[model samples]
Every structure is written in C-alpha cells, then in structure tokens.
Target chain A: MSGAGEPEVRLLGSWASPFVLRVMVALRLKVVEYEMQQETLGNKSELLLRSNPVHKKIPVLLHNGKPISESLIIVQYIDEIWASTPAILPSDPYRRAVERFWGEYIGDKFSQVIRVLRGSVPGDKDKMAGEMFTALQYLEEAFVSCSQGKQYFGGDSISYLDIAAGSHLAWIKAVEKISGIKLLDEARFPNLFAWADRFCAHPAVVDVMPDPDKLVEFTVKHAAMCAPK
Target chain B: MSGAGEPEVRLLGSWASPFVLRVMVALRLKVVEYEMQQETLGNKSELLLRSNPVHKKIPVLLHNGKPISESLIIVQYIDEIWASTPAILPSDPYRRAVERFWGEYIGDKFSQVIRVLRGSVPGDKDKMAGEMFTALQYLEEAFVSCSQGKQYFGGDSISYLDIAAGSHLAWIKAVEKISGIKLLDEARFPNLFAWADRFCAHPAVVDVMPDPDKLVEFTVKHAAMCAPK
Candidate 1:
C-alpha cells in the first residue's frame, strides 16, 4: 500500500464476472499487487462509470487512474506493462496473430452460447443445442491446435489465449451441471476437458474463481434474464 | 511479382465485402505488395476453404502460404511483419488498449446497424434507428478522444483504430443515401462526418473502395435476405 512512486493499480470488478477473474489471474500470475473494489451488477458505482463509460461493465483495470476495459485487452496490457514477467503472447508477430485468432474466437462463440443457453424460444431449445455443439466443436479444434505435446494452451506456460478462453471453464461447468446438458462431453473434447481441469487447478487461476455455491445460484437466478422474451 | 526471398503474399477476399477492404487499405498504407484472389460469396474456393477452416469467411491474408483470417487480426499481423512501416497501433500499451477499445466498439454496433438497416420489423424500424444513433454518438465520442485537434482518429497518420472503423464509412454513406436517414449527421458528429470524407480520400483507402454502383446493387439485392422474417 505504501510504495514510493509506484503507480496505484486498482481493479473495478465483480465477483460474479469471469472476465474480472481473467484480469485478477493475470495480475496474480505476474505477481503484480493491486487493490480490488468489488462492483454491484445492477447498480454500478460512480467510479466504474467514470472509468469505463463506454461498456459500463466490470474488469476495468485502473493503472494510476487510467482505465483499461475488456478482459483480453486488459490481460494483454498487464503482460505488456509487466514486461519483466513471462510473456502471455508470443514474441513473433505471426505467432501472436495466430494466438489472437483463437483468443478472438471466444468472442465469436458468445452469440451461439447465449442462444444455446437461453434457447431462441423455449420450444426451440433442442434446435439451438445442436448449433451450440457445432460451435463447441470449432472451439475444440482451436484448443487442440496448440495443445499438442503441451500441458497448457500456450504449451508450457499460460497464454493470453488460455486466459481468454479458460476463464469461461468455471461458468461452463456450472451451466452444464445446472442445465443437465453434456456440451463438453469427455469423449468429444478430451483435450479441452483436460485443459479446463488443468486451468482451474493452476494456483493463480484458482485464486480468482467464484465460490461454487454462489456460481450455481447465479446461473439459476439469471436463466430467466438470459432466456428470450 | 515478388523477388526470390520475399514471402508470397495473397488475399482471399470477396470484392463485395467491406472487411476485405480493411486489410487492403492496411497493406496499401504499409506499401506491402500482395496479390488479390477474388472469392465469390455463395461459392467459396478450395484455397480459402483450406486457409480459414474456422469461419470459412473472406478477407483472409495469406502470408507465404500460411493464412491469417479475420480482417482486424490480419491488419495487426501486417503491422507486425512490416514493423518499419508507419505503425498502425501505438507503441505504448495503454494507448494501444484505448485504441483497441474503440476498434472493438465497431463490433458492438454491428447488430445495431443491421437492425437499423434491415429493420427488426416494419413497426420496429424507427426504434432501431434511434438505437443506431445512440451507438454512433458513442463512436463519435471515441473519435474525439484521439482526434485531439488532428485530421484522423489516429491523429495525423491512419491507425489500426482508423482502419477498423473507417472501413465502414462507405457502407454508412451508402445506407444514408438509400435510407435518407443520415445516421452520422454533420452537426451531431462533426468530427466523424469529416473523418468519413478524409478517410475515403486517403490514397491507400481510395484504392480499396468498391465500385459505387456495384455496392448499391448488392445492397438492394441483400435487403430481403437481411430483413427479419
């Protein structure tokens, strides 16, 4: 707290957010000390509003008062600022882009996931599940590409891609159990299944995970809001 | 024709697509020479199919036989490889994140623009247009943050953010002409409206614009498909 001239690093985040956890894990991975101010979802704090006026969402990392939003963007920024720490993205430009391609794919899957979880219509639940499976297969292929002869997505160490997709593993498992849908079937996605297990077990990753009971409670409560009107 | 050592660069893209133009302008700005292999929308080629197996979509930049898909990702890759050329993203991580935030906002507006253009339903047309305005106002604010008494969103030189958002100007203008709604109104978005003109007139940007009449014709043809059923 009393470091001379060191920039005050603060995180405006929510315990309910995996995106927030990504930044927290990234910060912890680098051993960067930061203060956390938990944010209420519905009634956001004025500080967050001032920090990230655009999205008005959490996981905004304030570096000496300047705010950086978006989970992937924040994680990358963390890696860059803490250059002394192990690199999250590759040094090579081409490799970085390839990593970024898969990292960005997590965003690509959002709509399909929402449709899958909520169902386009309550009656259309089965139809949307098919679409979600097709989408999950593509993600499985992405994970497999870099998992060859390696433990993590980045091979030896955790990467921006791993943090990008791995943050969702907790939520996915919670959804799977609550919804009773075996989306990440062990046989269909052995690599991703194992990757999720390994990601959750990582000490830094474990530090950011939400309480198990609270997570299930959240998914149950939010299912109606997620469902199509 | 490339020299012996120069990597063989190729772009698999549809002339009708705006995303392809983003990569085109980026390459031109960097003075990187690349051959364009046009792709038909409905009928994709084997090269494109093999290159980008994930999204099977266009604007894939093939570098030395290795393919990089997603226009924004490709643009960053081009910036990285041609490092000496005028940088697209800033060298500073914080600045780069801020820029990425705006670049990413373009994605947020896509659905709003579609809803505005296609109309969710006949009665819902006006409501969608209002949402588009609220969205554009945010983009205008983003531009103002970086413009800072300069010509472009990137200040003097075009940037990743500039290419990301500027690529859509033609579509916005075309939509304005066809719909007569004037989404980017001069008084409301003084900076962004002028930016559209300046961006279009840039030599590199000019080289990538589609045939005006062809663009309008394609829009007319696609209206029925884009409309909510």
Candidate 2:
C-alpha cells in the first residue's frame, strides 16, 4: 500500500516472467508498496490489455491508473517518481549512458543470442552460443569498468544494468541445464559468474527471483514448443 | 565552439544517417555548440571504434572526451547535461515513459517494417507496408493523446518521440518515390502526415534533414545490394 497522500500503484505481471521480475525487484528496491495482479499466459487480462494496448504484455506498471510499459522504461519511471534513496541509475550522465548502452545490449543482443542457444529460434546452436559467450565476455569487461571492484554494477548498489542483466540469470541457468551447455563459465567469465551470484543473493532480488528448479522444469516442458521447426 | 565553462562536445556521425540527425536536432534544440566528425560508410574512424567499442557504431557524442552511443541515449544525455529549456523528454514521469514507449516503438516496430518495405530485407512488400501504415495510424492516435490537439507530440514542442519518428521522414519519402508506394497517406494518417510536415519544417530539423532527391538516388544505387537473393 502507498503511504498517505501517495498515488495508487499496481503491477500487472506474470509470475515467471523475467521482465516482471525486473519490475518487482525495482519496486522492492524503492520500497514502494503496490498491488500485483497476475496475468495468465495465453489468456491476458483485460486490465493488461487496456493498460498496455500496444504491447499487450506484462509487466505493466500502473501509477494512478495510467500505464507504463517496457521494463527498462518502467524502472526509470519508478526511479524518477520515487526520487528517494537507492537510485536505480547513476546520476552522472556519462555513467547513465554507459549503463543504458549495456542494458540495451543485454536486451537486444545477449538475450536474442540466448534465445537461439535455447532452441527458441532455429539456428546454428554452437554459433549462437559462441555469440552469447562473446557478448558475455564483453559484459564481463563492462562489469569490471563499471564496478571498479565494487560488489554491484552501480558500485555497491544494484542498478539499472544489474536489473537488466541480472533478471536473465535464472533463464540462462535454465538454458544451461536443459541444453547441457556452459554459458556463464566461471573461468572464462569470472566477473559475470560471481556477479550473477551476488545479484541473485541481493535482498531486493532474492524474494522475487524465479525458482531455478521451477525454471528448469518449465523449460523442459516447453522444449518441444521451442525446438527448431 | 562551446561557451566558456561548457564542456568540449563533439559528434561522430554520418551526414545522411537518420540516427545521427536525431542527435543533431537535439543538440541544436538545446542550443549547444559542438564539433561534427563525419564517418565514412564501410570505413569507420578509429575514434568511433575506440569510443563505442561495444557496438562500434556511429552517432557517438563525445562530451569532454567521454563517448555516448545510441541516438536516444545521446539525446537524453544532452537533455540531462544541458538541463536547459526546450526539454527533449517531458518532466512528468508518466509523460516521459509515454514518449520513451513511442520512441522504442519507432525503433523496434515502425522502422523495422519500413526496412522491409524499402527492400532492405527480403519480405512481402505489401504486407510490410501494411504493417508500417498500421503503425503510423497508431502513432496518429498516440499524437491525439499526447498532443491534446497541439502541434507536436510534446504538445506544441518537438520531443523525443517526434525526433525518433520524424528522423526517418526523408527515408520514408524516398521509399515512397523509389517503390511507387504511397505511405503516410494523408487520408489515413492525417495526424502523422501533418505532424511530419510540421516536424520537417521546424528550424532545428529543416537544416539537418536529409535531401529527398539524394536519398532516392542513393536508394536506386543501393537497390541491387538490397535486392532479395
């Protein structure tokens, strides 16, 4: 629940969605209480449809009856609106741009390559996995630069990049389990592997993070659907 | 030629690239002075490569030697660092999210479909154009909501969405001429049609907008490269 005089907040989300998990973690980080309405897969809620007519997808963050779609945009909106302690993005413009650049890379490149590796898209699996590993190596370098040996990307605090990349940890792990592939190789990607561990263990993320076993089970069941046609 | 105490600013971009034009418009709107380094096609500069190592793409803005890549991110960084009048993004969090949503839609959906329509990628031309028109019509509705009958999506001022969408006007027009297809139909997309005209005529955009004739010629020359194999 919002504090007195605070506007109402609600999140339309699916329990197992990595995107939804991002919003949940952001909300928790901000300590902003809100209602969660679960959106069923295949049968999206009317509220979800009405809230995000364009994408018609979860998670949509509704503040005072207005909807904000897209996880990264929603997270930024939350940060700006709340404007309290524990800033999600860095205040410095350059740093913010760097974080955003990597965040986009995570969404656009890293995740897409992983989709192929996980058999969602028909492709040369080894080639796709190699691309994913290359991207991960780049992200490892990014973490080194951004963290400066700090625990998190934002240097001691979870950040936009952390949430953006960290949200996919479970899905990546599930892919590893299902495909028998080593993606986040400890020796090759020490920074990212350790960072993933720390990110999942973080207070704001732990409760909302998807269960690994459940993800593996879900991925196994959906393997046929995702298999290369 | 920044003012005293202003940081040294430079832009790495190609003259005809719509993405570069976006950053140019934003910089001009904020009245910021900067140097421009034109990058050649297929032959990128070491500065661009070093500055934006992750993507190694153009339209990189160097503010005091620190580089910011991605047109939208650079625009936001300009808006934030300058923090002057004629804001690129709305001050209200919700409005900002709205603009960001539309901006992403332009990049992710509208522009990709246009790529197909222009023969850049092999696809059903008619179907791709239909999708493009649908997206334009949706933008028309978005304009009605965001503009509130005002002249621009930002309500009387050009904004991030306007830049994101409007930057592609020349290419869209060139496609219409080259392919002999009528996109941006006045009858169907009245709001966007009118908005495009207004947007193109704006002082900040007019000077930097690509020449339609040049674009058509370029398209004709490159048509062979883009033809479906």
Candidate 3:
C-alpha cells in the first residue's frame, strides 16, 4: 500500500532521549527513510504538542501525516506499516506477547532503577543499586531463555525487546559512570552485559546512540538544575 | 495448535483487583474455559508466587503450564491463542496501535488518577479530583475519535481498550462513593460515561465485575488498616 510513492515519514525527537533513540533505531533497522526534527525540552514545538496532545512528549512518528505517539507504539506502527524483511516483532502471537511482557518490564522496572541511579528520584543509592542488580539478574535469566542461545534477545537479529531495552544503553553507562554503580557487571549479568554491547554496536544503533560521556555531562547538569534551591 | 485436547487454562487473581477483572472479562469474551483461583492478600499462594516471580502480583494466566503475567498481555495472549470470534484487538495494525495507545493511557494516566482518589498515595484530594476529571475528559475525546460513532472503543464490540478501562469501572464507582469525588461526570464526559455503563453491562464483563458497594467497604477497611495510628 505504501507503494503509492515513498511514504512521507517524519520523526520528532531530541538528541539525548533514549525513547527517541528507540524510534530512530527501529527506523534504521527497517531501512525506512524519515526526516528527523530535533526538539528542545521546556520550549516544545507546536507540532509536537499537536501531534501528541495527551503526553505532549517527543518521538512522535508521522507516517504520511498521521501521527503515532509513544516510543514503543510508534515502533510497533513502523513494524506494522513497513511489513518488510527483518520484522521488529516476532511472527507468532505467543512470542509477541512474551516480547511485549519484557518490553513493558524494561519500561516500568528497569526505567525506575535508572531514575534512581541518576538521582532523578531521591532514594538510597546502595539500596537502588541492589535493586538494579536484582532486576538485571532477572533480565539475564530472561535473555537466556528468550534468546535461545542467540546473540540478541531477538535471536541473531534485532527485535522489539532489543530496541526497547537497548535504547537505554547509553543512559545505563552514563548513570554507572556518574554514580560509581557497577550495574551491568559482566560476571553477575554475563548474558545481559554481552547483549548490551552487541545491541549498542548494531548497525541500526551505533550511529544513533548518544555518547556515554556527553550523556553523563547532560545528566549531571540536568540533575544540578533540578536540585532544591 | 491448542487443539491438543483442551489446553489447561488457569487464572490466578484476587477478587477486588481491577487488573484481575480484565483477564476474567477476556476469558469470558473468548468463551475460554478456565479455572479461577482466588488469592487472599497477605497470604498469597505458592502457585501465585511461582507463576509471577517478577511482580509477584495476581492476574497471572497459566496457559498449559506457561504463565503470562500482566493483565493486558494476558488478554492479548487469550485473543491470539483463541483466535476465535470477537477479537480483543483490532485486525488492522494502525487501528491496533491506536487502541494500544489508549489502552496504555488508561493504565498509566487513569490508573494514577484512581490511585490518588483512593488516598492510597498521599495527595491533595481536590487536585487529584481535578486530574481525574481531566483524564476522563481526555478519554471522552479519545472515545469519540476511536469509536467512530460506534457503541464501543472496539467499534460495535467490546475490545482491548474497553476491557482495560472497563475493569476499573467498579473502582471508579467505589472511589466516587467513598471520597464523594465525582470523576465520570456524564455532563462533561458523556461518551465515556455512557461507554462505561455499556461496558459494565456487557455479557463478558457484567458477572465478573466486583460489586461497587463491596469494593467501597473493602477499600475503606484496607485504608483504615494502613492508616497511621
């Protein structure tokens, strides 16, 4: 259906957002060409606001002018619309459900851990680090079973879960560097540690992922600004 | 493939949980035969713990020994595996994405609003009531667009978004009764208000829905138990 000429695809995102990186990775993985618009936080563009009235956040995908918001939902929309080789989601429904479960897990559980590590949420750093380790340990077990002895969670190819969790790679590194927290310990979470490396190095992800050093600087500055007067 | 002589389906849930009610509605909708195991709070069953090791929450659907946690994920699994009439999600991917966006909105936004209303999270009741009304207003707009003048978000059928938001109907009512904070104001959110009535009365949902009066009593008792002496 998209053969009605190349679909006009546009992505609204910021430079450092991991969520935006997710949409970028998906587009690159699917080989879909799109125009990227950089958005500045606190002074959002009207288009971004209009596109996603509910969340009013970035990484809204405009497919031939119809906007799809939410990073994961937009990725799914890309996967569905493109419908080409190298599917983002698995073909089987059960497998798809499993992927979704982990994706939600990454968004909910791991995201909170990252927030704690970044000092975005006030918490005992030691306690949060332990919680982070426990969550990654769970994901390590999940990767072993879900990957089926493959390189990525998608099993030899990048898939939904990969993009979902993988998008947070730079942020993970940045948080670890800034907080002196050893989260992705190779010995403790060997599978997840390796997967993180592979995911960051992937063709679709390498160019798009935020630099860990720059992220550290940004996160530190942002945290300082947000601290009480 | 589930024709492997009636797959053993069991649902682990607590009676008062809206999340649990979602799975119940989905099963009833699909006409899927399932064993319902009631779990008591403070005394969770080992099966419940084993089935959902991560969140360790109720509403875990055990399908032929494979456990799927999370209410929405379980509903999708049921829809996929059953693959029968009255699909929970829309067939078109774009439409599915739209429904998913709203489903997630209900879970994230509406759920938070409800939490505030219940006094579960300490907050000014007036501010939370305003937020609850604002969220409902958004849903009202979402229904108008998504429903396309149809009776339900699924367009003539009670679909994913319906079950997701519908499960919380009793809780919404109970909060209204307990706090006297009106959320689903018919005058303001006519579409969603009417949709709520229709959703509650749906065959798949009616019997499984927790009684609003009972829920009010339970919520009050539970809140009292947790209150500071």
Candidate 4:
C-alpha cells in the first residue's frame, strides 16, 4: 500500500470484464497493493452483493471494509488515497475536466458499441457496424487532438484517461473478431490504433489485461448466444 | 458560496435537462450562491462550448472560473467545495459508495426511458416500452426495497442519489404522456411516486425544476416532429 496509515485495499472482480480490468490497471499504476477476488456473475458471492447491493456488479474495491463500486469511482478513490507517485490525473482543473469529459464520453458512447456488437442481428449488422465506426471515428479524432504525439491519452506519461480508454482495447479486439467487423482499421484510425498498441504495452496495463485469445473466444461464444437470429 | 473564501459558483444548463437539474438541486441543497445560464442547444454559447468542448452539453458548473462537466462530477465537486451544513452525501465511505451506486444506476437505467419514449414505429414502441417497463420493475423491486421507507433514497434526509433520481421526474412525466405509458403508477410504485412528490416539494429542488407544463408541451411538440406520418 502507498499510504502507511491507510487501511488495506481489496478488489472483487471478474477476469474477463473490461470494467474490472480498469480497476486493476489503476491499482497497479498507483502501486496500491490489493487482495483480488475473482467473482462469478452466474452466482455472485454474497459478499459481492452485500458490498454493492445497488448495482450488484463486479469490480468493487474495498478500502479496509468500505467498498466502492464502479470502476471509475474506484480509480478516483485510488487516486485520492494514494497521492505520492506519478499523478494519474492532471493538476489543472480545465485539463482534468477534459480528461473526465473523455472518460464520460467513453462510458456513454463507446458502451453502446459494445452493446451493439454483442447484440446486433444479422439483418441489422450493417447498422451496428456504422455505429461502431462512428464511435471509433470520434475516438480517433479525440486521440489525435488530445494525445498530440504523446504515448498516452492524457499526455507524455500514462494518466487516468489512458487507463480509461485502454481498458476497452481487449474488448474491442474481441468484439472485432466476434462481429467480423474491423472498425479500428489501421489505415483509417492510425492514431487510435497506435495509442491502443502503446496502451497495451504499458507495464501496469500489460500486467493486468486478460488473455486476448481467451477473451476473443469468450466474446465470440457469448455474441453467438446473444446475436439476433 | 458556502466556502469561507471561495468565489461564487455558477451553473450553465437548460431547463429541460434532468442532468442539469441534478446540479441545480445539489447547489441549492448546499446553499451555494450562483448564477444560471440557460443554453440553447442549436446556438450554443462560446462559453458553454469552451467550458465543455468534448461534450458541449450542460450542467457545467463553474467555480472560481474553473468548469466541471458531467452532472455527477459537478455534484461531487460541489459537495467537496462547499463543506457547510446539511451534507448532501454520507461521510462514511461505504455509505457514500452506495449513494454513488444509486446515482450511477439512475443515470444508466432511467436515462434509457427517454430513448424508449422517443421510438417512432409501432414495433419499436412496443420493444422500447417492454424494456422501459423492465427497467421500472427492477427499480421498483431492487431500489425501492433498498430505500426501506425513507423519505429520500439515502434515508430521512436528502442525498445526492435523491437528486439524481428526482431530476428525472419531469422527464418521466413528459415521456409517459408522449408514449401513453405510465410506469410510475402511484399504486404500483408508491414509494417511488411519493419520493418524487417529496423531492419536488423540497425547497432546493422546487426552486430549480423546469415548469412542468412547459416541459410537457415542448416534449409533445418535439415528439410530433420526429413521429412517423
């Protein structure tokens, strides 16, 4: 743990969820030692439900015994608790707001991409593909403008924005295979593609990401089940 | 402002947006002195765009010239900056996390009702209504049960979660009128309906909610424009 007097941290999460991966990356980035418990969604442990009864979702981070749900909230809590090393967010308020804007944008916009890719019918595949492409286009524009040749989304060093966006990389790749629609085309989204490569290469992120091949397999199988006939 | 040495806080928002109303209610509950700027979406002011370039959507709160976007972010920022009487959030980390979970749930789940009510075709309307009903059922079962007969979402006193959920009352009513579907029936959702009434009665919320009749008129007109002939 980074803080000597602070309570020990524990994380409850599932291995395959991109949302769960986000918390893992933030903890690793902050160098906050935490006890990890892999949760099963089918039979969510009583403790997991008790800790986050409102959402009853995974990626719940418990500081001492006080649990914080939502991956972004957990990330902010981690930043607040561990203030020593490389700051994960910018100090300037405007810039911080900008980073947060991107975070919210991803949560609001790209989330739909995941939903569409997972649930799109064969007849509506083209429509879903278009939505995914539009989201990617927006992401590409944001990356090119905000990143400005930096290795990460928030700038030279990896910040929370990179962690936020990076968490989706494995899922995006998995969805590409499952849906058979490559929205993140290198020729079209060079900046986003390059950023994804750099994001996955980061030590903290690399250490936490689920196995890409297994993720692809799982997503493909799940998509087949959810796909509209 | 509640803070001893801080400058006044101002909110830029539209009267129709529930997201904006959340911030307004939070500010009122905190007793923060502020100004209001009603933004027109078609001709967004330079300040609104500059304050929130990425989304350019309101409920942007400016504190000492620094802007905070995202309704929940602005609420937390408001709570942190104005540490005066009648705390809008629980100080306990666990309770605070629970509050946040509900706040996020309202954003994620209830927001979908807008999309459902906006559906144009008969099949789309039925599908969306079914989904909206499912969402309402979940809230009635899970969220109302969790409230445990409290006056607010958190308990006796209002909290951030109450503001988040309460802001949707006008929109919910408007959508119900447009779609001829009432998910928030008084008998079926007694606790939720009563809570909405209490929420609107609260001085903080009462002062800022958009004119309900005007909101209904606007929504009906807008729906007509989008409805299939």
lDDT of 4 by residue, B1-229 (tens): 3466555677889888899998988888887778888897578989999987767889889887778899987887677667786778776555665667667876776777575674432346666667666656656664565567677766777888788778888877777777778768888777777787888898988877777677778866766776689
> How big is the positional error of residue B6 in model 1, measured in Å on the Cα after superposition?
12
- Candidate 3 ranges beyond 4 A from true positions: A1-7, A221-229, B1-7, B224-229
Best-matching candidate per lDDT: 2
The candidate that wins on DockQ is 2
Give the TM-score of chain A in candidate 4: 0.88
lDDT digits (tens) for residues B102-217 of candidate 2: 89887777667667766767788888788787788789899999999999999989999999999899988988886789988999888889999999999999989999889877
Candidate 4 Cα misplacement greater than 4 A, ranges: A1-10, A39-56, A62-68, A81-91, A114-150, A155-157, A175-194, A220-229, B1-12, B27-69, B77-91, B114-158, B171-198, B219-229
- What would the TM-scores of all predictions be? 0.88, 0.93, 0.93, 0.71
Is model 3 an incorrect, acceptable, medium or high docking prediction? medium
Q: Rate the local accuracy (lDDT) of all candidates.
A: 0.79, 0.87, 0.87, 0.76
- Please, what are the lDDT tens digits per residue for candidate 4 over residues A28-89? 88887788888874689888999877568888888877778888777776776677777887
Q: Residue B92 lDDT in model 3?
A: 86
What TM-score does candidate 2 reach?
A: 0.93
Looking at candidate 3, what is the lDDT of residue A45? 91
Q: A200, model 3: CA deviation in Å?
A: 1.7
Q: Score candidate 3 by DockQ.
A: 0.75
Tens digit per residue, CA lDDT, model 3, B154-186: 899998989888888998998898788778888
Residue-wise C-alpha lDDT for candidate 2, range A105-173, written one tens digit per residue: 887776676677666677887887888888898899999999999999999999999999999888888
The stretch of ten residues in a row with the least summed lDDT in candidate 2 chain A is A218-227
